[model samples]
Target: MTTSSLLSGADGAVELRGPLASRLLEKSPAMKRLLVYLWEHRAEELNEYAIATEALDRRSDFDPRTDAAVRVQVARLRQKLKEFYDDEGTLDPWRLSIPLGSYQLQAEPVTKDGAPPDLAIQDNPPAAAAIPTIAPQPVVAKPPASRYLWFSAAGLAILAMGWLLGSRWERQVQMSTASSSAVVVSPFWANLLKGGRPTQIVFPNPVFFTWVDKNGDTLLVRDPAVNSYHDLERSPSLSGLEAQRGKPILAQDYTVASDTRAVFRLAQYLQPLGTKISPSSSTELSPESADSANLILLGTVGTLAPYQAYLDKLHFRIPEHKQYIEDATPSLKAPVHFETVRESPTRIVAPGIVALLPGHSSDSFVLVLAGYHTNALISYLTSVNGLADLQKARTSHGNPEFFDAVVLSEVNGTTPLRSWVAAFKPLAKETR
Candidate 1:
């Protein structure tokens, strides 16, 4: 009955047939299947493509770049395992974990005291081979000197969650929790946070073209028109630079510092009201998750492309791959186009929009805070003056549950100095 024996087929099959696997099966049949698949194929190098097609039964054409289903499921499975061990499996002599940066299942022995034997923890597994990017054309072999870096959605999620758990924001959240009983929630947030649904705050991981420079340093270029792998392949600018830089690879690893801060600020305000808040990256957002929880999306036009269905319905929106707000309302009023401007070497002016709409599910809601400069958009949305302006505008409009408002922010570099509401319009509930 040694714990090491659990790694054997017979012992493993016994555990799988026991209550542990059954619990996972009860949680999600797909998760149980994934666990069994990993257990059976423990010796093989499990990549995203293989796991998707083989374990998860994804189509042969499944692309890991655009579709994060496999990664999401794996992450959920990992969480489920940790949950099992923390509770029901506390007395189990062995624990299974998927090593970070790899898809292999690992078994670590546990002591009688319910703790692992004293051993130096190993560093994260080495990075895997670059998963192929999604493009219209077939992937061609490239020189080893130049290669793409496919960012993992799970890794980015961990980074984002780590920030949320940082001491700075955690302290602020603690303070907010103390005074939460006396604070009154505003109508804007009240409408969204009603029904006690969990809130998922998604921050964008915008697309960037990365290539190694002549000096052996990696350089990142952001072209507004290119937001996806497909866009990177067809860009006219990339074609000219391909000779020297090879083909530029698309990655969504970088998050604007302002966006992360905004999420913290938002969580600090909402958590005090007994609302559960979760921080996630835009890449990690899925249709099912969006429908199940209240979502607060913060990002630029290119980063928010996945939500184009909702963005299209907004009367005030920055066009795809562009940095300006256009008024699409067809009325007697004049056309509205507010573009980003450079007032001086030290100052910048940008347009932002705050839109509230119904979610995919009837009970869920969506709050989109978008702009060319997210620093300004989020700053305005969370500010007292900015919220007062929004409240005043909504009050005049009879306080519709769904609405869109355009705001202008004066910024110095990445910091937003001040923002003002430019326009507001209430929409019917069925507008979605």
Candidate 2:
């Protein structure tokens, strides 16, 4: 007959405030308060103005007719409720919900297979369908009848609720669809792809051999050393060393083999983000170029110019760049050093650095993927199961935004071997 009678006899009104209410309160205090208030007065003629003032604690002059804040919050509350049921309360026998277009809280007893009871419009007439306007069954109010006031209030509230409920549902559906189609990436790649800037890949062309003046003989310097012979090709002091010493100038060309595999793999990995990596020559890319975009330094330290500058800034030292030597640590116990064993021609212990650092400029990130030599660097980026290994390393280090870790790449020149986290620096503070 009336709104009160309809609500009192409703099938699912009693258990509306039980388990679901408690969980809702835990996640969102505002939603909990709003849901409780609406449930308490579900039977009365509700107006948007009244709901804003009472449940939302807005100012007395707050215009629910114009301000859409209440509608927005209600939409969020519905989404939160959906998440709760989908996750935390998935198996619960009783499901609580606020029906579309109405604030009335309903508790429908789910069947053996989670089927909700049939809530046809006839059985639950109070919770109206999505509509522009709705006339809730009239209530016999105070005498000298405020008929216009009651009707207008009821109409305004129901219209606000009904139209917005349907619209919010659509928005939620769109959001879910968007998220499903969104980019998925490894955590380590996130910093490199930060701010959606163009990513630059610096392929390391290692200095295989260079012209050098050693004593009176100008020789081909294949060894990278601290007291290395002067690069006769580029050194001003050693400009005429080859001619003066009566020796042939060694070939100045030094380049590592192209890692076509890492390039393709990275492209596929970043395809979801709609990013394309630009092939930047190590010599072509200057400090200023590296500062403008997200940089992925490929291969060994040779590929990355000014990497020594970075090491200086971060207080790390790797002497004798040719072979893997013990790092000059800030402390002997510091978790930032390398142990090398020269087995034969190459260093037996090949350690690598997968360091993420802040970009030189805003919205920039510099990812350093380097090692003792070309082989080690290539292994880390491609053959070492890099993405998986690096992700696990990042996780082990508490997943900091900036990190530098020593990855011991146990590889015997392309033969499969294990990798380990030799050392970790979870919080590598950026020196800006």
Candidate 3:
């Protein structure tokens, strides 16, 4: 039988004989779950966390410990498959194996004449006594030409069918691959504002925030409290704050659209006094002495109380930031106006900004936080954006659960950040 013919039929149970069948029987439950998931979602691209979480039965239950365990199981499963095929020898008619980094099942057929030794069994037994004999019978001969014609026709039909099916399968695979690449290569700003879970880090005192992206690229953003600004008077280099200015710090090649000049100015303003400004300062900062002088000075003009009041006044303008605060908005019972609640410990809300970066023709997002409760804010942000489950995974695992961890800053708060964080509680859990 030809390889194409092997794919025919709804059940296709016979086609799965040999190594594939043996592997299925021998695989562990976790390995089986992983395989089944890959088979079901073959048309869709999945990440490691998503695969592991699904296999574990609870997407929110992932941790480093669990992740390590799953990796070990998959390794063992791969080894077992290799040993099974090697022992069965080339006689096995089918190939069964999992490709690395991808949880996919690949199968192909071998010629029937190549059937494994274990599969060849005979029913007739040889006579114990040599005295038993039988007469030979005349054999009928078949035309070789007719047999060749039949085989050729079958081969042609299989080829035509394979071409049609294979073309469609190739298109599906291309589309899936393109979609996955787009998601993976998306810019940092895009992922931060609108993609995965959103994390807010509030700063009690100005501290430099730093974190690494998947590509090992470093991102540095100073809090409003940093007390120093970028000194535009100094020469620029590809390192430090100068390299970051103007150039879109691409995450996956996506750029932030917010005024690169403003970002440069912000970075400069955060630089401490006596710090030399970059030579590229002319490209980003105004040359006026007043502007240059004003650029480098940084100090806390007011406390959290006043800052919270200022934010409440502009609440309507900042939708993303306001949505987060409103969801976790604390209750107030008094003759106090919303602004009055700003300075009080109970009323002090952190100030945050969500800036959209433009790349090509689309917008990506970047968020900056100023005030107390950075961790709590990040937890809250992730929770509200349907990414709380990812946060849970990271908290349990001791590392981030997604592609990026833009920045994190420690700050004190009375309650667990999770307590104030709000999840997108669905009105109905099921559609039916």
Candidate 4:
């Protein structure tokens, strides 16, 4: 379809209007303006200089060589368009697109088989397939024109009704697949799942000191300082108690309540996206496993002790007290301390840290979700508005490849009311 035909709100065609009309593009004025400018001048042969000057309002002397503002905005707008098509705009008759290495917006219709009309058939498709493209049916030799004379009007009507029903069925399936793919491409999930690599949902197995009496009475003790049975020897309080209780045996059977819930949620979220999810305890993880898959560590500060080296360079930390998140370097925008605030007897505000760090292998990634409450942290990471807030936070920091942020969640008792990103810091690139 022509650009004007698509934009003119033609019958069964989707319209591309102002920013107010698009949920995904509304937050970005630059992207909205760029989209509208491209649509208005879809017929023109445009370049980066024209887009920079006409759409972005760049200075007349602006140089595209040294400056890359236009390119950056175009890249972001491209991603947003893909995300929009995969999500709320899934059923739109025509899909909007911008060709790579260029600034032009192209519209392609959704063919009956779901693949774009211009898409070429591939010998082999990727394992993480979204919607499979239907192969073209074999062409049969045409018979005499009089062969169609056998069909009656009632027969033709029946065939039309069947086609309508079949088309509706296919659209329903497309919507289902598109929604799942949308999550994989979303801001929060894209980092981990979009790579199409196996994701290892690593949960912590914190050490617990247990004393079993001769009478079959057992007492369990959890000291924050003790990570291994060897570490228990160094703790004076735990050693003194061990002396009276005979001997303390180490146990790694328990996981934090939040970690369990987070694991379940992660499994439910990723499984639908056709992501290969492997759930393992932190104790089972090694350098080799880290090198092969994406890692998502879910638990409290104690659970993060094994990976403390990753946090050494990060600005925020949950100290021994486990009460507040501390920022080593404070700025006017980022506070030194993100302490818990009591809004009322049952309501409180607490801080959580969501850090995306480089893994042992350059291709792999590690996502650390550290917080006291698992529900709020995972809920925030999964929700649309929550991820949108995170996207805004990441944008403010120029959209770093790897970064960490302090997210605040308002909770009433055990229930989380809302979550928002309070501070953000772009992580330094890992040195070889």
Number of the predicted model whose TM-score against the real structure is largest: 1
Q: Cα deviation in Å at residue 99, candidate 2?
A: 64
Query: How do the residues 57-124 of candidate 1 rate in per-residue lDDT, one tens digit apiece?
Result: 99999876568787688888788777787787877776777744446564555756667432211122
- As for candidate 4, its clashing pairs are none
**Model 1, residue 281: displacement in angstroms?**
1.1
Note the Cα lDDT for every prediction shown.
Answer: 0.64, 0.49, 0.30, 0.63
Candidate 4 ranges beyond 4 A from true positions: 1-187
Give candidate 2 regions above 4 Å deviation.
Answer: 1-184, 206-241, 244-254, 258-265, 299-305, 325-337, 341-349, 373-397, 427-429
Check candidate 1 and list the clashing pairs: none
Once superposed on the true structure, which residue ranges of model 1 sit more than 4 Å away at CA? 1-184, 213-216, 240-250
Report the poorest 10 consecutive residues by lDDT, candidate 4: 134-143
Clashing residue pairs in candidate 2, if any?
none
| Model 2 worst lDDT run, 10 consecutive residues | 139-148
Q: State in Å the error of residue 162, model 1.
A: 11
Task: Report model 3's TM-score to 2 decimal places.
Answer: 0.25
Total colliding residue pairs, candidate 4? 0
